[model samples]
Target chain A: MGEPLLRVENVVKRFGGFQALGGVSLEVQPGERFGLIGPNGSGKTTLINCISGTLRNDEGRIFFRGQDITALPAHRRTWRGIARTFQIPRPFGTMTVLENLRVTLEYAARERARAGDPAVEAMEILAGVGLDPKAGAISGLLTQIEMRKLELARAMAAKPALLISDEAMAGLSSSEVDELLEILLRLNAAGTTVIMIEHIMRAVMRFSERIAVLDAGEKIAEGPPDKVVSDRAVERAYLGE
Target chain B: MQARWLLALAGVLIVGAFVVTRTVDNRYVYFAAYGILQYVLLATAWNILGGYTGYVNFGTGAFFALGAYTSVFLIQAVQAPLVVLIVAGGLVSGLLGFGIGYLTLRLRGVFFSIATLALAVVLETMMVNWEYVGGAKGISIIRPSAGPLFTNYVQLLFVVMAALAMGAVAVAWFIEHSRIGRGFATIRDNEEAAECMGVPTLRLKLLATTVSGCLMGIAGAPFPYYITFVEPVSAFNLSYAVNSLAMPMVGGTTSWVGPIIGAVLLGTLQQLATVTISSELNLLIVGVVLVAFVVLAPEGILGLLRRGTRRTRA
Candidate 1:
């Protein structure tokens, strides 16, 4: 692959004396379907948080699109076309789905006001996430799967070159997971890089072009899905052998 | 079509009041209307942050007091025009709002509210002890001469206050319909989601609080001249905070029309109570009305109207 879209170098995050992420490093290439998987408490979320500027890492450098973004604030990172969906779906409950997308579109337009293209762009995003018809419904009234779709719609509304899906398949049935996975695949096919962090092994294994296994805040395995899944350390980490 | 009818009816009522007050020469009615206008402005200003953004500021009285004192000092020191003083008051209060919001917007929920309350106490003490602007003794304002419209200064004050009231309403309408307004609603509903969706929550909130404070300050700036006195106690009156909080809550905290309805209804009732009943009982009546609405009509009059309309459609 050419230049990596995102690079995390030796990220170290501590909560007082506890090290949540101990010198973790990773890279996501442009238009790559990368899977970040680990057992619980292996710092998957912390790593993503540091990359997204939600948490400051004491020792790390994060480069996004060939620029240092480590010290940038969350909204600044968002404006630079880095978008993320939370593991727990967080739609603006008091507003309609259309209003939620509109706010995101307006924010992005304000940052990069290309003349006369925002509304059409927003509607296209809504259509891509399969939320166009439900746009007028109140977000609080959406079902669990619908809320997840809205979260994805919101992330896409910023027209990010890279999209981070943090456990978007959590709490969904098998068919629902397939539906969401299909959407992620379609987005990746359309030239948007995707980093999907999921605990659902089958889905991640099927979706990731390359898999990286993090165990106890360290990269224990990195390879094709089949090789990483069968690695002695990856198996031991999951089975706690 | 519906909105135009409402506007026409409002115009008719205002013109009717002007004609009747002119014929009867009732300075009292004009004074009452002026007070109602002030409350309308205050409630609308408070709603900008408290209602729209879900950030309840208990320190509105502090901003109001700051505006009153700023105007008093400027008027006494350099004899600025009333219009200039009003705008200056707003600018001063807005700056204070920006400073306070920068420090405290990180605080969530009731902590932010408590911090704002403490701000009022600190401001009141500072103004009470500072002797530059007459300190605890208070400042007296010499009313600016009216330019030949009416020898009766009260009528002129009423007109000015009415214009300001209209301006406040227009601002509330603009914000309610704008993109900033939708961003505020998102922040109110879920700040994390709002930020995730790329809304710059801090900047939008700061703008809301600053604009809210500026308008409150302008509303209070003219009060020193209207009452012809500026004392720390009255300028920092806890009643201002109470009315600012209660009017919006009692009117429906969700819409622009809520505060207007609350202010006019509650303000007229308070004026009538103060005139006929004991002045001390006026506050008692306010407290009673606030409690009644909080318990019985938590969504306020506007919510009631919305529900009534929906039922009719059904």
Candidate 2:
């Protein structure tokens, strides 16, 4: 009912001749668990990149809590409380895992984190993502799941009102997926809005209150998880009926 | 280390330099030490941008020469004091660094290195044609009288250089331990990720260039007085470019201590080679030592020492 936490209004992105994102639009509410799913090359990543200010959309405007941020640079967008995990983990290789979170805490969350010492706050974030024991480990040498957890923890260090998880569960074991899902669930319950772009159907169906499906850069279906799964177009888009 | 401890260490070093000036009567010793100390300042300046931020600037000589030239101009026009010359030189080169960074930082990797190389060539050409600060033929400077503090002008220069080198190192140490240093590390490791994490990579890179350039320029501000001649060719010597970069690589790129070690070791070696062999062999020494370090310890002497200590502890 109130202004959506994030609104994407008909974004178009073209890489030379090919349109990576073709006029896609979506909205996510405050404290909502939203899922965005598409087959490979359905423009899910492109759309998110546009929303996160990594790739500027050609035609659309983006709003975060009623502020137009479509023209902002990626770092400025981050300063405005939008944090994202890379689809492929991009841990700061030379720094310790704890230092990685410190980067975000010192920069993105500096204004909000006025009371706590950055090291103490960084350790608290690492603990929340279950990476406290590896706090001193070099981030580049972390195991895949640990890197993913570090990525999430680093994102959480921003204290973002909106957290974008992009294929964070990819290449992760099921138990790892469950663990990450639990973290996401807990984060959402504690008043953070989450946009999960995942390929894992079971995780999506279980976690999302509502889901939006993208097919070839278009939103094919969006509704409550059960209704969206049973929709004929959603089935066709996944199974090629 | 805490800033206070670092300041105290600097105080000790300055006192030691003053003692050497008092005790040693040999002028050549001051000459040789001044050369070595200049390298310490230059290499430390280079590492602030090159090592900390992963931006390789091949235009080290350009900034150094600019500072020297700034002094040359001021000396001819206003007969400014050494302090004023140093400040003016730093401001000029700092502005140039910010301008160049704005234009060229958009190009990453080898392209950025090439652009910096081009910058040295461009600056050299300008200096060669500029008549006010002496053209390609060069100009001689009459040495200023040494004040009550020292025995002669060269001794005064030696002490001044030692102070400058210590100040440069103290500044580098401060940056290495601060939030700016952490931001720089992220930019080095992964820039895009750094930006997404809100590190403000572009602004930080500009800050790096300005600070690095200002220090290099400050090191150069005394050169007109030190050498008593200002010329394009010698002022933009190829050895300065090579030594500033090589010293950091040989010492270690990660911390401020590495450049000082590299500069002192390599510089002393080169000074010895110049005395024992020929001055022409200075580059050859740098070449041989750099190759050895790159192959045996690519992380520099500090990295090797760190590995050594870790192994011993284990």
Candidate 3:
């Protein structure tokens, strides 16, 4: 699939004597809807954090867009078109919704200064996220779903080609999950590769093009969503079958 | 458009104040204005890092002392122009800021502030023992001529201080409206979120610290000439820290104009107290004002003004 957009090769991460991620490896293709799932303490977040440069891998290489990005700083990785939403939406509480988007827009502008008007680009992003109406509202006062949307909007503001959404629908209801899934589908349709790390089984089954299950920092199964869900190893890992 | 009009009104008022000071022959008025100007610059500088970036700096006295001593050394060594010495002082302080920030920007709030305070104490001790700078006895600067066109150097110094204050305010305003300002706000609010969103928080914090230190240095650089003496006691005085810290806290730590307003009101009151009441009473009043604002009007006078304006508009 056009030389995988992201590749993690034998990545290892440790916290003193405890190994958070032990030689984990994964690849995400361009425009792919990849699902990352595992039980709690399965190193799902640790693997993503290492991929996103939030934590450096103890060993192994991370290649992004055909280049070694192993040692690149988190912001530099973002500039290279990698953006992630937090597990907990952390909007700049003091700023308005529009201003929160504006900060990301400004970072993108600084990186690509020669690329036309920044304010117009910022507004376009807000519109895309369906947050144009509440643009001037204080971010701290936003409702739960609105905050999730803002988290996505901020990730998209950098105009990243690859978007990592970490539990965007964590605390939402079933209907809210569908709403967020629709937004992610729309974003993916516009050619942004998305890696959705979610624990919701039905949503992940519906959204992921390819699913990978991690059990205790190891990839126990990888295949089509239907097959992966039906795999004995996956069932045993989740339900202790 | 509304903001622009407010800025224009501010500009007019500032120019009018300068004109009145220029025309008036009253020394007391100039002295009061000069003192306010110093506090305004110091508080504004402190606000760059403390308010905008959400990094409270307790080392205001260190940068101030650095500028004062740099001015003294340059004047004593090369007899340079006051303007040049001021710039030199600012550059030296900026470099020091860069060095300190590079070493300590990884630290979170209180730890960073404590490191800076430690740096200040260490620097103060070094200056106190260093004999070339009069070894705590202090060095008296001979006031250089301001040319025949202007005879009253105090008035000239007042004008210079006022100009510097205006420049500091202008820079703060520009930063507040710019992208860097927004980035700083994000860093202050949620640093991890900011980094994930592609903000280079470390670099931005360092930039704020450097610029803040430079401005503080420039504010202090003229003190030896303005007061015509420089001693460790006055240069590295804890009062500098108290004034810098209190002014921003009383003004509202959220906006550009907060510190400027706080500095002027508090500074004018202090000067008046020093003249009419005991010198110690001035600090006592500042302490009282600071506590009152912290407890009751935490948003400060400028915050109240902003709220009042918003309420009126609504």
Candidate 4:
């Protein structure tokens, strides 16, 4: 196969003396829908933080499209096409929904020299996710699902090749979950690779083309969803052995 | 381009101040206008960092005093022109601001604020012990004779301050509407998110500090000539810090207009109170009004008005 889009090698993270991620390795291919699953505190978010440059790994090299990205700051990583949504949606509260996306669009345009109106581009991103009607509404006034969509749209505004969505569907109803899933799938179809960190098994099962299960800060299993779901190690990791 | 209106507004306001200077003969009016315009400059300058970046800087007094002292040293040494003093003051304070931001800006929230507070205290102490620039005993400059254009020095000073106030406001307004302002808004909203959105958060923050400090210093440069006396005690007064923060909070911190509204409203009220009551009571009145506004309208008068208009529309 061609070179993978992202490669995480022996990534370890620690808080105080506690090892949150001992040594986890994984690879995601270009244009693939990847799911990172774990029990609570299984180092899923830590790995995401490491990959997205929010937290640097103590011992690891993160490669993006054959380029080492371990030392880059978060914004530099973003400029090079790494974008993520916080597990907790953080819409710019004081800004209107359109303005919220425009912030990212304007930055990306400056970095990459895109020639178009950022406001129009911002509206397009909002419309793509069914948030166009509330373009002028203050972001803080958005409902939970709307905020999640906004989080994704803001990431999209960066025109990132790799998009990470951390717990984007938490606290969402089943229909809302499906709606968000559809949005992600549509984005993937449009040629953006996505890594979805989620607790919702149904959405993860339906969406992922490949799955990596992290347990106790280690990669316990990696395979197709069916095989990984049925594996004894994965089973014991979810429920006590 | 959209900010051209602000320039026009500045022109009108400056002309109006000149008219008042030409028509009104009373020295007190010029004095009062001077006070209002000074706060206008201070509040506008302070808001660039405090309001925009979500970084609260308590060292405004230090920056202001540095500007005033920059003028003092220049006069004692080379006898610089007022314009030269203003430019030098801005550059000097801006450098100090940038240096401080580089060293201490890594500390977030209240810790960063404490660092600035400590900086102000340390600078004040250095000024007290320093032998040059009058040390403990203040220095006074006999007033320069009235300029050919203006009838008196006070009138010229009033016009200068009015022009500075308008210029500061215009600069603040431009930044608020520009892409840099959006980046600042992101930093204020959620810094981590801003970073992930490709905003060079640290650079934007440093720019805010530099510009904010520079404008404040420029405002301070003319202050020595205004008072005709330069003293560490008065130049480093706590009121600069208090009034700068209060004016923005009372007006609204989000937009450029908020600080101007705050400076004018609170500024006018204080001037009135100082004349009718005691000048000491002026600070007390400011204290009381600030508290009332904080408790009643935490977002300031502009925020209150926006909400009121939104409600009426709804």
TM-score of each: 0.93, 0.97, 0.95, 0.97
Over the stretch A44-161, how does candidate 3's per-residue lDDT look in tens digits? 8888898888889999999999899999888889998899988888999989888887788778435654256666676777788788899889999999999999999888887888
- What docking tier does model 3 reach? medium
Clashes of 1: 0
* Runs in model 2 lying further than 4 Å from the true structure: A113-115
Candidate 1, which CAPRI tier?
medium
Q: Write the per-residue lDDT of candidate 4 for residues B1-314, one digit (tens) a residue.
A: 66677688789988998888778899988988898889999999999988988888888899999999999888888888888999999999998888766743378888888888888888888888876788878888656777787888889889999998888988898899899999999999988888888898888888988899899898899888889998888998888888998999999999898898999998999888888887887778778988999899999998899999999999
Better of 3 and 4 by lDDT: 4
Which residue pairs clash in candidate 2? none
DockQ of each: 0.60, 0.79, 0.72, 0.79
lDDT ranking of the models:
2, 4, 3, 1
For candidate 4, the TM-score is 0.97
Query: Candidates sorted by DockQ, descending order?
Result: 2, 4, 3, 1
lDDT of each: 0.85, 0.91, 0.87, 0.90
Please tell me which model should have the higher DockQ, number 1 or number 2: 2
Determine which window of 10 residues in candidate 1 chain A has minimal summed lDDT: A108-117
Task: List per-model TM-scores for chain B.
Answer: 0.93, 0.98, 0.93, 0.97
User: What TM-score between 0 and 1 does chain B of candidate 3 receive?
Assistant: 0.93
lDDT of 4 by residue, A113-147 (tens): 55599999899999999999999999999999999
RMSD of 3: 2.2
B124-181: candidate 1 lDDT, tens digit per residue: 9999898877688987788878667565777777877777777777788778878889
